[model samples]
Target: MSQEKPPVPSGRRRGGLLPNARDIKAWEEGGGRGLRGFLRRTIRAYLRWNRALLLDPWIRYRPAVQLLEGQTGDLQRTLDVGSGENGLARFLGREVVGVDLDFPATVRWSNHPATLLRAIRATATALPFRDGAFDTVVSMDMIEHLPTGERPKALREMLRVARRTAIVGFPYGRRSREFDRSALAVERDRGIELGWRQEHVLRGTPGEEFHDEIIRTVGAVRPEMTLSWFGHEGMRGLRLRWRLQFLISKDSRLYGLVFFPLYRLHSRGRPKHGYRRIYVFKKAAGGKPGDRVRRPARNSVRDPD
Candidate 1:
């Protein structure tokens, strides 16, 4: 079967202040300015603060506890690569180490920045830890942002560092062409040229005012298939409010808040091709002949390479 292609742009419009440049500089220096910089900082802060009230209590506290009920026989050390300011360590208890290049402004743990919750600036490709130092390693929604070519080395590093298990998750699947047609129509009618253009950021020219990220209202994730499906609505012709009724209705809110634990209970340890997915790998103990291993031959831009 042919692999389904996700709708992520192949080449982001490049020019003044590329995405990687901003991220790398911010990662190393921890300082950035301008509206974009402020937006990034603000988003980081919001994610950190909402970690406890929204993410932790809902997914980390109860669902994880129940899912790992029998499997927690011997979990001493857990490491979270790219933990960011999510407060995953606090919810995972003291044994967990939350590693990230940048530390959050605030954390829930009473202990100061110590050995367990060390916040070191490090890259995924070159992790600064000993082999087999962690029992479990986990990363969520992080792999996609990495350069198209660097994922395999990073995956190998995650596998190398973890003795027991590793779990990785990210978004997948294509954007619906149906949605695009309607969306682009609106821009045409308004005399606005929408979508990405290469010349928008030519050298010596001021940056264009075109929007970078255009969100299609019809896209959604099917957790079972890990498929991000788009709708028939094109860019100009979408009935945005009416079509997104499911998301805005009280039913969705209630189901999300009240029935989330039930969803977690049913979905644990069951790997489905969702519009997003969490991939898990377990390391075999001792020199087992049947154990599977992988190494990189070259740096390339292949998915799951």
Candidate 2:
């Protein structure tokens, strides 16, 4: 008799490592399929948003929509550091460039060049590009993967390379040395590190020293900037439009059927608690070039008691 699959725990998100051999095989084959799926879904979403914008005039200045539109601007040259899979790179105009630690040469970008250069491997402390090599540089949701000590250096390099704009996106909730406390406990108890030998466990609390550090680093570089936050519903609304397009058009059978809704709904967004934080910075145009300001001598300044 065949064995029944175990039930996924209630409230545990789907695709969180509980899959059969068949599922794994399917996913491995579906990696390329998934990328195409997201591209289709995102394009569909853009169309949907376009419709909604036409229908509802009030949303013309919505922060989320505004941010999405901001990503579509004409950039002569862009460097997407830590660009995983180059999704955003596709949206950039013809002059864009991409660099990543893991992308292989086999990876293709028809419009522009995508280079595989590990930020860490190239020189974790210094970037490989000449000064002001790009009009825009973006690092999306990438800083947390770095060692805590190295993040500031990376941010500085990002600032140094961009001529006009630099944006960095990451989870906003907290900056903790131990971002996943319970997960670490599980790893230690199991005597397995998953892949890495160690992992962070403690969540960074609000008003922590790290927040000040990030503010200092980014503020010194891009003093005039904006912050945008997106929740699960916000992302879902974007993806639902994409799904509608796939359903209506039925362009690619495999893509329309399995990939469209799968990406539309599942790729919706992270948990409510795990929403992403986006920071957008535009370099000052012939603006004041002031001296580099160092962060305070202490992690954070304290008022006298």
Candidate 3:
């Protein structure tokens, strides 16, 4: 006796991932056919997609945005060190330039939501620029990725290039390090080993000493510039939220879908304990904004600010 095929699940193909052929056929035969139906579906899908694109950045960069925008005038001349995939240009404006040693010649901006980023291949420690080359230079969540010795050099380079300000934001203190460790554990439990996470876990997050060092380094490099820092995103329930994002996997669209809204909702509070900190170093005076700061000479002389 021949056996009958099992019924397919609703809206799903039998033994496959596509929509059920029978259901699609039925819909085409009904009111779901023709130009009117196609237009309706297209508009709906576009709206949903637009919403997702609007929320494409990670929550980690929100404070960076606040700090940059906090300054007077437009962010017309800004340099982003260790810019990676985060589209800081989109938030700040097209005038923003992102430089990173990791960017391959063929590589462009990260597949971020608002992608107006302009990227260049350059090392942070030996930034190919003259002193006070930009109005503002910022490196967000990137210091921890540098080798311990290179961190000071990178910070000095940033200070040297920036005419008025240099900002460094990164996960800070023992709690921040522990938080990253716990999140890495979540990834390991699920057999997920992302390269970025591996580097972050192995390199170690900046702790109390790192914070103090940044202060002392600022004093040494640019004594006239004022240094101020504040911690953000308290630990309570942060792990659970991070665990969900890790399980979803940062490579997935589902992760992008929740990123901005989570930042918008989660960042409004005043939390005593935080997983990250932002340090803003503003020069006492000097310089004007530009559409594009001249890229330094190929063999430009480098110096401390």
Candidate 4:
């Protein structure tokens, strides 16, 4: 005889991992007027705050921050293309004009003291700035989101605007089925579906072919642009550790208790093929010089932080 499938939990069936339409409907139906609802909302808010402040900085952002810190040149006027919520700006510790397609209302702009400059709403393919506008341009974890054909254009625009350096970071190499399976198992065991978001538009391995494409595109404009790769290493135990930490962090803020020790252990050794890679492109010789002390327009919104 055929057996029936197990019924999914309301949270899973409705929202999968993050809060969804159905989840919002249910919460609204409950009115949040009763003591239990009030308590639930309060607890959730507290946990979210803790995750944002204590956990995300170390778990989600530390690698990129470390990479930038290691490679950054003399700090001057800077632009961060595709700077969603300005994560890199936090590590920069200075004024950086950020530009992205959209900025959600929920982001805490004031949290990062270094993001003192205004964030502009713009596109990566067509930055709304003049040529050689800034000394450094940073675009982290943003390129793979564009269509394969458009990636080259985005890179060209970044290089055109950067007078000295341009840094780009994204998931590199082939997508590992083994790693995907392990992550799925962890999320299943944790009773959550972590695949609710569809962020990576370009699929398949972003390996040799992708690197060659970038080189060809950048070469067209700045033939002498020096290209270098950082964090090119093996996966080793990094994937499993990352999965475990993500699952644990969902349960409580106490995950922070174990975060640093694990980070130190894993970070001590380099892998042969790391999941992420950073590309640094130094300006070609005889390129147009950058405009020092030039600021954004007076009408641009400026963050006082």
User: Which predicted model would earn the best lDDT?
Assistant: 3
What range of 10 consecutive residues in model 4 has the weakest lDDT sum? 296-305
lDDT (Cα atoms) of all candidates against the true structure: 0.45, 0.48, 0.66, 0.62
Residue by residue across 16-106, what tens digits does model 2's lDDT show?
7543334433443443347755644555554344333221111211222234445544554667666545434444433345555655546
User: Which has the better lDDT: candidate 1, or candidate 3?
Assistant: 3
Candidate 2 colliding pairs, count? 5
lDDT of candidate 4 over 1-305, digit per residue (tens) = 89997666475454355454455445545536688498457556644564655333343345545555644456477888877674556655666788888887655555663336567889899999888898788887677677777778888899899877777876676543245455667666868665421334224335667777776776677665677664432366566566576666545554534564666565543344565666777764565433221222431232110
Candidate 3 steric clashes: 0
Alpha carbon deviation, residue 25, candidate 3 (Å): 14
Provide the lDDT at 276 for model 2: 40
lDDT of 1 by residue, 1-305 (tens): 99996553234344533343345334334437887567567545533443323432234233333333445656667777877655345555555676666776755454435434656678888888898778777776555556545655676677678766666554332332223344456545757573321121111111011000101100111111111111111222223432343353323323333344443443343222222334445544452433232223331222220
Candidate 3 RMSD computed on C-alpha atoms after optimal superposition onto the true structure: 10.6
Q: lDDT by residue for model 3 over 1-305, one digit each (tens)?
A: 89997765477645674344454444445446587478446544533453445332445666667777756664468888887655477566555778987754454433444556668778989888889888888887788888887887888889889888777777776777777787788778989786776777788877766766776776677777776666667776466567566566544434544554665676765344567777787765442222222222431232111
- Per-model TM-score versus the true fold: 0.46, 0.48, 0.71, 0.65
The segments of candidate 1 whose C-alpha lies over 4 angstroms from its true place after superposition are 1-52, 56-74, 109-117, 175-271, 291-305
User: TM-score for model 1?
Assistant: 0.46
Better of 1 and 2 by lDDT: 2
Quick one: ranking by lDDT, best first? Answer: 3, 4, 2, 1
